[model samples]
Target: MLYKLNLEHILFLDIETVPQRPSFADLDENSQMLWEQKSQYQRKNEITAEDFYERAGIWAEFGKVVCISVGYFTLKDNERNFRVTSFSGEETRLLKQFKQLLQEHFNLAKHLLCAHNGKEFDFPYIARRMVINGMNLPYKLDLFGKKPWDVPHLDTMELWKFGDYKHYTSLKLLAHVLGIPSPKEDMDGSMVKDVYYNENNLDRIVSYCELDVITTAQVFLKLRNEELLGRDEIKKV
Candidate 1:
């Protein structure tokens, strides 16, 4: 079934996020209390909410998307090329740009938005952020009354699970196991917060996010028993 689907119909993507504030103290008193409650079980009694604040980006309520990088395959003259692009800058602005891309290009019933763990993370995260930014949910991200099979989103992690709900797979680990090039050469997700807040290197973070998008597309091709994309075939636009 995977091989039968048209690769061009998919828009592969990944997103990078950072906490809304640089530190817990940066948050208002009400926000700090909310953070404490939100992270109680995850941190347990061992770590303070302030200490766990670095991971706030994992929750949409506490984080803002710093970048959303996307890639898609285009076949010309029997040769395939992958075009990649990114939306970055102020959270609201970038989210709007991304929403426009979805509405304009990938809005068809047959089009799909593919990500490594999108259904659980990227897709919902983007939706939640859009709402927070006071934007309408694009058709692709709006899951209100849609039934399971009717939705046009693809999750590579979910595909890898194959009915094993208890299993979890990170994109880096999956790429390694699948014999695709690693996207975490320079840094990993854990380092994103520090890179964005401390180092102030959004370009570096954007590069990292784009790499993940490319790697995701490669992983999808591998899953379908298709040939992997060559570096020359990938163009960042």
Candidate 2:
């Protein structure tokens, strides 16, 4: 199936997110109480809500997306080129840009949104954050009543599972095992919160996110036994 897939129809993507506030104390009183309750099980009496707040980005309700990087294929002169782009800045603004991209270019049934573990993280986070920001759900992101096969989303991690439901693979590890370049040289998801909050470096976060998108596309190509992208073939727009 992967071999027959049209690369141009897949929008490979990755998103970087951070806690909605700089610190747990930054939350309002009622929100603080809700955080305490919502996080109790995950903390497991081992970590306080304050200490665990750094991980709030993993949950859509307690976090905001800072960057979304996406890549798609274009054929020119019979050579495949992958173009990557990103939306960054205020949560609402970046999301609106991303939504517009989907609505304008990738809304068709033939188009799909792909990411590493996106089914579990990137896709739903964007959808939840969109609604939180008072924006309507884009066609690709809305899965309210779609059948399983009808969902226009692809997960590289899910594809790697190959029926082993218990298996899990990080994008970095998958890239390593598959001999694709690693995208985590400078930073990682664990450091995104600090970079955005302390260093105020949206550019760094965006570069990291874009590399993930490129790496995801590379991994997908490898999975389908296609040639990996050459350095010159990846264009950042």
Q: Tell me how candidate 2 scores on lDDT.
A: 0.94
Which residue pairs in model 2 clash with each other? none
**Per-model TM-score on C-alpha atoms:** 0.98, 0.98
Model 1 CA RMSD to the hidden true structure, in angstroms: 0.9
**What would the per-residue lDDT of candidate 1 be over residues 1-237, giving only the tens digit for each residue?**
898889889999999999999999999999999999999999969899999999999999999999999999999899999999999979999999999999899999999999999999999999999999899999999988999999999999999999999999998889999999764468889999999999999999999999899999988999998899998999978
lDDT by residue (tens digit), candidate 2, 1-237? 788889999999999999999999999999989988989998868799989998999999999999999999998779889999999999999999999999999999999999999999999999999999999999999999999999999999999999899999999999999999764469888999999999999999999999999999999999998899999999989
Runs off by more than 4 Å, candidate 2: none
RMSD of 2: 1.0
lDDT of each: 0.94, 0.94
Cα RMSD to the true fold for all candidates? 0.9, 1.0
